[model samples]
Target: MGYRFHPRSRTIKMDDWIFSPVLQRTYASTEAHYLLLRHLFEGQPIAYCRVSATCNSLNVKARQYHEQMGYKYEGTFRKDNIARWGTPRDSACSSMLDDEWPLNKSVLLTYLLATNFDADGKQIRSLQELRTLQTRCSL
Candidate 1:
């Protein structure tokens, strides 16, 4: 666990984002990874973390887990739920965006592209080679 201080409010934010993953099964600690990715793109300072969303029909285990993480309902997505399942599922939704945005993702997705491989090891060849690979040369 670690903490970061805000310059203006002099507020102290404690975060275990990295370690959160290890303790995720208890709550959203497991799902925090996805949030981390989202936060990376949003580029905000995250003081707290969790790994679940109450927006869908998550299992009871997940619901309890999220509750333990200190996330309160911000709003309900009653319309979206009714538009789909309606009374059948009685599916309403909620969120916990208490702050505008938090967390930074200076290092997020790192994809290794075909554009960076050599002729010997890379499958990305010219259009002609692609056709050849599609068909077998064997009789």
Candidate 2:
């Protein structure tokens, strides 16, 4: 998911991803997030980027996923918008800065390019797993 923010802002918004249940756990959205950030940072002067999710258990997972991708929690806006049933929903915001891109890009590439998946396509090392290993090695 990629967005073209207004010229006044140097930020890009990461949009949502939807896929069939069978395609879940494939890390497709993770790959797309990496590709979008890479393209934006490499092609233009993007100093910041953000992704938002609704206040729900699923969105909490989404937030965690964004964090694993190197975004920092920026704070949430309670009752940000009304949902389908007219219930107010909160928005969880997370962001990444230009200076933080290199490490994230390298980490994501390592996961995407790894050949450790088993016959059923389950990953041998999850993103968080690889990130921990990367952090340990860096230290």
Best-performing candidate as measured by TM-score? 2
**Count of residue pairs whose backbone atoms collide, per candidate:** 7, 0
Residue 100, candidate 1: Cα error in Å is 8.4
- CA shift at 49, candidate 2, in angstroms? 6.0
User: What stretches of model 1 exceed 4 Å from their correct place?
Assistant: 1-52, 55-58, 74-87, 98-139
Best of the candidates, lDDT = 2
Query: What's the true lDDT of residue 29 in model 2?
Result: 64
Which ranges in model 2 have alpha carbons more than 4 Å from their true place? Answer: 1-4, 45-58
TM-score of each: 0.29, 0.78
On residues 24-114, what C-alpha lDDT tens digit does candidate 2 reach at each position? Answer: 5667767876887787666555444443323332376677766787878787777765665998777676777777777778788888874
lDDT of 1 by residue, 9-88 (tens): 42333322233445644223423644643543244554333222443343354444333333344433443333234453
